[model samples]
Target chain A: MLKVAQPDRPDALTWVFLGLGLLLLPVGLYLALSAPPDVNQGYLARIMYLHVPGAWLGYLAFFVTFLYSLLYLFRQDPRHDRVALASAEIGLVFMGLALVTGMLWARPTWGVYWTWEPRLTTTAILFAVYVGYFLLRGAIEDPELRRKAAAAVGILGFINVPISYMSVKWWRSLHQTQSIDLTTGKIHMDPAMLQALLFNLFVFTLLYLGFVRFRSLLAALEARKEEA
Target chain B: MKLPVEGWPEAAGQGRVGVVRRVVLLALRDLRLEVRDRAGLLSILAFFAVMLFIMALALGPEEEPLRRAAPGVLWVALAFGSTLLSTRAFALEVEEGTLDDLLLAPGGKEWIYFGKLLFQMLLLLPLAALALLMAAGLFYLPLERLFLLFLTLVLGVLGYASVATFYAGLLARLRGREVLLPLLLFSLVVPVVLASVRATTGLAEGLPVAEISDWWQLLLVFDVVYLTASALLFPVVMEG
Candidate 1:
């Protein structure tokens, strides 16, 4: 009952997501730039517009990978594995962007590009976990074994996401605590800044959705060509 | 003189205790094999000694620096040593072509995972203690709190081995697994290593139990999570 005849191109929804996300990106940027500066950090805080969304999507993307990986194990479906791979690849890029932007911000704010604080260390470890995920995927030659191994890595490696997210609160270390704490549902920022941040998050999520769909299609094509 | 698989049919009828017995028997069998083999065990021990000696030389000639660097060095040594051991967990099975035989046994496959994990703990704990003693000798690491330090060792090694055993099994049949195992393992076990190091440092620094308890709690959480997650996923991944 495997679905062999799949469409070669991304569907209408993928195009819509990519088109709308790109169209609204400049608007989101304008809002972030015009938003009132933080009382303490001033304009330096604007980087949060990019950094926060990047980190959020990174976490979101990995969570998706984790889910689809589980599904792949249970169902033995190539589509599920492809989705997991695409999500992980996208997650790595976004996580890398977040890390780079963070270092840029930290250089001016914390006097160094990197520090061994809890948040930074956990995030780096999280990044390394996915990098290993890709390495494991690449090293395996058998397709079924590769999918199984990658699924296991995808599931196990997700253990770091929550630890990285909560490291600031747990250690009370150098990193700033979440301004929009998900656990407490607390909003401790100016409304203007919050609005801009939320808009940027929405746009990044749209782009992530489009990217994953497109990447999965590319993966499916590769799989077909390998078979042919 | 029944083969392990020949006994599984009757053992499967025996339920939970049978599973427990199977786990222990499997672990002990592997342990017996490991002890008899000798080379793997001695090489790991020698690896620890040389590692600690070089680390001591690099950070030493001063007790204060050696003492300060002791916890980090000890745990890093243990981490590397365990990777060496973990690959051997399933290496012999694959080489012998008996892995498929083990899989062919009746009932849930989780016991295989637990059995391998137990073997790792049984082997790793003693080696870890010896490594701890070596660190104490060379790096001036304090031994007054030996019990607490050993507790950290158990929790940390369990966490590390749980994932390592799972990966070692997953990659057992693959070529280049020797290079790949550590690359996959070190990232996942960072939290365990970090907490264990912190706990050891606190004990060495003579911190009160209450302060170090936080690290112990973190290690325990990681141990439980890794153990549960690996056991649950092991069967699914190992299946065709």
Candidate 2:
């Protein structure tokens, strides 16, 4: 009888990256929060440090998923599928973080927990699409078929992201908050504040890479067990 | 490429004719199956009508509110109805294990996808017509812009059927997909639904065609984009 292989431990690189993220996160957070309150919005705008990077990484993770999904179809390798799934899972988590932080940011600024802001609405839809992706994966019993279907879903879902952003933008103009004018591609900020924001963005990106690598290993191990 | 196979004529002629023949035959096959088994059709239409009734009750019988809300309610009912039908779109194939048989016989996977989309559109025809009549009665809609309303329905139905047909095949092999289908489809289909409702509302309000053109254009773009994507991807999904 074939024995099921155990789930692989996160290797040295995973640990190194994760450790760097763990050590740097609080320092980055402190630096981000240390920026002086905005002249117009005051302290409420500080949430941008968390919210912006979270949103950027969220979109980045989905792009990675799309890339791997395309590669999976082309390469016909289960490893690529595993990477796509792991990236999507992490992407969804990042998206959830972005949404919550956005909600928190919106409350004092927009005067409501939610508004039909273009980015917010598009993010909500993105969240739902990936939720459906995981649901699809869970619903299918056959591993090979599930991977193929999921890769297709990943591709389709990514295609919708840009279209959703464009449609929502056309549906309404950017609600120009004090700090960011997404429509004009102009972000007004002091150099120190920008430094803090960029630092957190880097930290979050590294964290995303570490998480996906670890998750993909677990997925690969699971596939090995399934095969056995 | 010349095919030396038995019973097949000129390869170019076969390629050109085969696709149309396959699409029509598959569509007819599905339509015939529906006619033979009217239960699904009747139940789905009944469900649609009842939902409309419930919406009318919920919004109350007042003419002003009903008139303003009519387009949104109508599209909601249509969306729900089409979603119901799509969930069962592949039930027959799954039950009979004939989806594979059809795949094996296909000129291409796209023909099967288009065939199913055509069949769903045919099924929606009477159902949508009845829903339109019901909405007109319940909400006192004007008859002047009937053409635009009908156009919106056609485009809306086309876009919805395209996306829903793809999902139907995707989820056909999964367990508990009946619930999953709507959850996934409704969110992804927001642009189509939003554009349709807005266009219909503008028409109902007697707005000039220019005012509603944005929504109309959005619907057209959505229909073209989704219909093409569904056709291209359907084979990969069904085969996978």
Point to the candidate with the largest TM-score: 2
lDDT of 2 by residue, A58-107 (tens): 89889888888878877777778888898899989888988998788766
lDDT of 1 by residue, A85-161 (tens): 99999999999999999899888776678766555677788789899899888888888889989998998888755
Residues B86-168 of candidate 1 have per-residue lDDT tens digits of: 99899889888999989988777889999999999999999899999899899889999888999999989998999999999
Give the CA lDDT, 0 to 100, for residue A77 in model 1: 88
- What's the interface RMS deviation of candidate 1? 6.1
Weakest 10 consecutive residues of candidate 1 chain B by summed lDDT: B1-10
Local lDDT at A14 for model 2: 75
- Which candidate comes out best when scored by lDDT? 1
What pairs collide in candidate 1? Answer: none
For every model shown, the clashing-pair count is 0, 0
Off by over 4 Å in 1: A1-5, A34-39, A163-192, B1-11
Which parts of model 2 are misplaced by more than 4 Å? A1-13, A170-188, B1-13
Q: Tell me each candidate's TM-score.
A: 0.90, 0.91
